[model samples]
Target chain A: MKKNILEISSFSNEKLKYISGLKEKKNREKSGTFFIEGFREIQRAQISGKVKFEYILTCPDCYLGENEEDLVSSIDAKTILVPKQIFEKISYRDRPDGLIATAELPDFSLSSKTKLSDDPILVIEGVEKPGNLGTILRTAEGAGFHKVFVADPRLDLFNPNVIRSSTGTLFTLDVFQSDIKELYPILKNAGYKTFAVTPEAKSLHWDADLKGKVALVFGSEQYGLSEYARSQSDQYISLPMKGVADSLNLAMSAGILMYEVLRQKSQIDN
Target chain B: MKKNILEISSFSNEKLKYISGLKEKKNREKSGTFFIEGFREIQRAQISGKVKFEYILTCPDCYLGENEEDLVSSIDAKTILVPKQIFEKISYRDRPDGLIATAELPDFSLSSKTKLSDDPILVIEGVEKPGNLGTILRTAEGAGFHKVFVADPRLDLFNPNVIRSSTGTLFTLDVFQSDIKELYPILKNAGYKTFAVTPEAKSLHWDADLKGKVALVFGSEQYGLSEYARSQSDQYISLPMKGVADSLNLAMSAGILMYEVLRQKSQIDN
Candidate 1:
């Protein structure tokens, strides 16, 4: 809610060029910054205090709902007020709430989340879809898993779809990319058993001894767990696929497993 | 494989006009037939033999994988071969597999799925998104629930998104629409315990006794189970939302609860 306001109506503006360039993954990697488009999402990222914002873009005319200005006022960042047409051109959402914040990508390193949970260490490998990745983070957060490690990510962690699908839970959770090969040794050193979810596995998730510290590993929906992922596991677990479903979507698979982990922990606690 | 192939290339063709017009919800409603685009999905619908196919449109050059011709040859219906451009124009997929089948909407009434399972009855109510509906059908099938009763559906059963997201499992299950009011009485008469899922519900799904004949009821993601859905339910149950997640996605919610029902049954079976 700083007093210094910068208005950029021209599409060719330098700051506008940099903002639109962020839609590309290469630019995000180069800048080490990503944009969160909704006021609710931006507020979540701001509240987490993990990310440092450079600026916020607002189009008061294009806003869909309440208190968007309040969010703009709350965050200590340069504010850009553009016309509705200029704002819509930059917006990714169908019904945007007219606030977008650009923030420095915080560390998703597994090191940032050590000692966060005694529950299952949730690690996702070679995730190809941003929606799945985002949904996984949301599911992990919802199930009370503190940190989710992304190993060999095919998509960027801050893909707008990931932010949207996670409903801004991305900021609340410790989600970072690490190599799957490197991840297992650390998990093992930390006295954790690793369970890779694969369709080939004979073990049902229900039968697995998740009462102890464990890591639930998953691969892309297109490819089940990698050969390395399967080989490194302490056990192989699977959900039942009875009729026509070849496999569950990655996020759905993660949800079922995370809740199973939660359920087992609740049994112990109660 | 039946070989009744009728080739049509012109976009202005009368039959092609009908196929493209079905893209509109109004056209689909007027004709009482919906189009499912994808080779795998058409094959499932053909194999299910529950709905009568009106015709199929295919473009061999546009197919991404094998067996397009085999599917066209198997179904005993009129086939029209078009160029890649015509197929792409009608396809909702980013990567089209070049098969679109038109079929009359099948009966979605609970009576249609009668005697399908002694397992927990699966009932989805007031679902707004086609993707969620499709995923719910896939989850029900995977968890070994034979029939999925979609009550008061907000979207058509055979929406392209539903067909695609379900991975063609829509054809393999008994999916039908009926009012929520009508569903429970029939379920009650059939000795099924109806558990409506809502966030306001005090009982957790894990703690709920689901061993007996039961029905898991779900509402739209935006609005939890409707008042009729909640009040009519024998008990209201909720999935845990530990972090910032307001609620689980409709499909993910269904997946967790269906698996929970499956887990309890597995215990008794052992």
Candidate 2:
């Protein structure tokens, strides 16, 4: 590991202010950086080659864990040692393991991920909840979907809550943010069929043909797919709701659809 | 509407203290009551008959909304109008809709719900996250599963987070907490087949016959089903994971499986 060039205590108000400001999307955008915490998450971000770490901060007292020596040494980023109190102030988790890093946001373009996969692309529109967004990304990566496009995202992908919930899968997945109006033409031009998820849709997802190059579009839990999304969809489908609850959480809905896409692809491959 | 025996101000320290104490599980259990916030949630709890409201606290300045008058008038519980400051102090939500209530925890004995349904029963073992627990309940309800048994729940069902995340679906569903050791015999005696979800399981959930009386068992995300749960299960099944992630979130896994069970049942019905 690089020898620490900076030692920070909780009393360093200037540094604390700058670090805390990263919590907001605008501040992160202005600085072109975001925070990553926990050893596993930081390592995943680094290994993905998407994130460029500016600084890795750790509390020597309780930060390092088993096999973390090699993980720490592999980082080319500047290393800093901070007191436990300073780390706690910047950490988001209830019981933080003390490793935190600030990294430049990944520059993902739809053009870069064009040839990434032949399977369906997951698209989320007007997603408001950061936790839901993060969980969808984690599920997308786990389902082996290479490209996920967030159309009209209410929360930035780099928000600490999103990063934490994705468990660093955010860096591994090829995620791009664009307006649905802008994305619709691109997906159509790329010969993709879009299936919009809505509660009112008569088509059950299982009955609909999910095979081939597809884009599974879902809207925020509060509002089903936006009018623009519905207008562009090749077909409208829904996961059947049988009981009293009106709708499923966005993440669960997206997860079920992504896995269905994966399951269909596996069947074809076999 | 209750013509107010007590009007509370933020400065009423004793009243504030009692309401605030309901935030903790121990306090809720000691006094046998829990907090419910938001007009929609409180209304649902009242209508379900499962949750008994002890008191209804509304901030007159901002509490009443369109149609809320009818909802409020319907509640037979004691009503108290509190100052905005006092309402804000006990409100868990950031945008408090100015409605809060203290409700008696429903006595959800397994015996009371024994005749509830012959449909699949969702069993969650060692669930720790309130959000996950709540979401699963919401999903279980949406999928039309009548009864859910939590075996070794880490968080109490009446925790504010669970109440909030379930979107008050907790009141509508037949939920009970029981030990895994105690629950196995009960399920078996009822002619329900217990299918434990685990990563190492050989059977794919889809291939398994999920037709008649079934109990779908899921464990905490951290640790799969306990040895006791596995031992008591009739068959062990898993949701196919084809990506780098080892497992799905507890809620999502439960949702997919519950829906799968619903799908099979629908197929048989047709």
Candidate 3:
């Protein structure tokens, strides 16, 4: 394991300042780096080999055990030991788990030969909430989708909050940043049917032909799918609402779409 | 509008103490009350008539305008103005939005004919996160699920966090607490298929018959479905996982199952 080097005493430590500033979207973009907190998430990042860690910060009293230390060693990150109070000040959670990592963002790009199976591909547009984006990524990964393309990813994928909300699946999945305008041609050329998930659509999600190579598009909660995204799609589908609530959360909508694809693919495979 | 009665100055105010205590489940249970912050949420609660408020606390500077005051006045809640700092102390969110309502918990009980429709029901077992519960409720409401039977709900229904996460859908849906054992016979007699959602299940979610009246069961992240809940289920179904991740979040799983049912029912209807 990497030996502890720096003893961070203040929140204004250069690294600490950089990490705290990453909580905002602009800072993350400018730095080309982000933070992932908690032991489990950092371990996942280490195992995935996609993240390049600059350093790890931990409390002296509750340092990572040998097994965890071994995992951290493989990633080649510098280690720092800090007081518990210092750790707490930098933590986003109510209880800091005494472990945090600063890692280089994964350089992701969509594959030229996009795999279009019978299962539907999830296309997220302008998803604002980090938790919602992370949950959708976790769901997309779990449902066995080949790719989860973020068409205009609003939040940083490597945000500590996103990593926590995703339960570390963000470390494993294929996530790319692109807009609907750029992605539309690729989807259409691939012969995949595109379905924009919206509330105002006349047909229900089930009515759509989800069994084919499909790209299921979802938009922001405040505004549904953009006009451009909707126009480019082959079909528009919606979840039926029997209650007074106007719309479902973006992540939930994506989850429903992913599962519908799962359901259809399973039937065809069988 | 209800006239502002007290200008809260101290942190030790009885009302502030009560609202702050809601951070713990035990306190909420003992007091039979919880906090609901945000203007839209409080407005929804008032419109639903599910919760009776003891008081509405807000910063005087951020208090509603005369037009907004007219809307608040009709709610019949006792209004109180507090310093922004005092309001911030008791508020869970970073920005309080100048509204926090102390609301008595609704007496939630399963209806005798709890089967609201031939469409599916969602049964969540031992879900620990209020955000997950709220997201599931939002999805259930959007998917046109007849009722959501929260089996062994770990968090209180009136949790301010849940209300916020749900985007006010909690006010418009039928949410109640009951045991899995209590629900089994009723679901069976109603000719509903009870599908326990697990990663180890033999059948994929799509391969299962979700068209009829169905009850999709989900469990906590730490534990899969409870032994009792698993035993009582008619069958177990899983979403296919291609990635290294074993499972999706509880709310995501519920969303997928809910939408799958919607898809099936729509096909049949069409």
Best-performing candidate as measured by TM-score: 2
Per-residue error at A114 for model 3, in Å?
9.1
Best by lDDT: 1
Chain A alone, model 2, TM-score? Answer: 0.93
How do all the candidates rank in terms of lDDT, highest first? 1, 2, 3
Per DockQ, the best of the predicted structures is 1
Q: lDDT tens string, model 2, B1-270?
A: 546547866555676677778999889889998899887788779878887777877786765578666666678777777788778878898878888888787886555346635789999999999999989988888889878998888878888888888888888787888888878888888899999998889888888999999999999877778989988899999888766677777898898888889878988888
Ranking by DockQ: 1, 2, 3
| Candidate 2 per-residue C-alpha lDDT over A1-270 given as tens digits, one digit per residue, 9 for 90 to 100 | 556557767655676666667888889989988888888789889889978888877776665577655666788777777788777777888888878788888876555345535668999999999999988888888777878998888778788988888888888777888878888888887789999988888998888889998999999866768889888899999888877666888999888888778767778888
The candidate with the higher lDDT, 2 or 3, is: 2
Q: lDDT tens digits, residues B1-270, model 1?
A: 656678887889999989888867899889999888887788888888887888899988988888877778777778888899988988888888889988888766666446635767788888888888888877888898876788888887767788888877888877767888877788888888899888778899999999979899998876768888877888999998898766877888899999999999999999
Instruction: Report the Cα interface RMSD of each model, rounded to 1 decimal.
Output: 1.3, 1.3, 1.6
Error of 2 at A156 (Å): 1.6
Clashing residue pairs in candidate 2 (N, C-alpha, C atoms within 3 angstroms): none
How would you encode candidate 1's per-residue C-alpha lDDT over A145-259 as one tens digit per residue?
Answer: 8778889888888899999888888888877678898788888887889998887779899988787687899998677678898888889889988886557888898899999
Worst 10 residues of 3 chain A by lDDT: A60-69
Segments in model 1 whose C-alpha atoms lie over 4 Å from true places: A7-14, A61-66, A83-86, A109-117, B9-14, B62-66, B110-117
Q: Scoring model 3 with DockQ, what do you get? A: 0.63
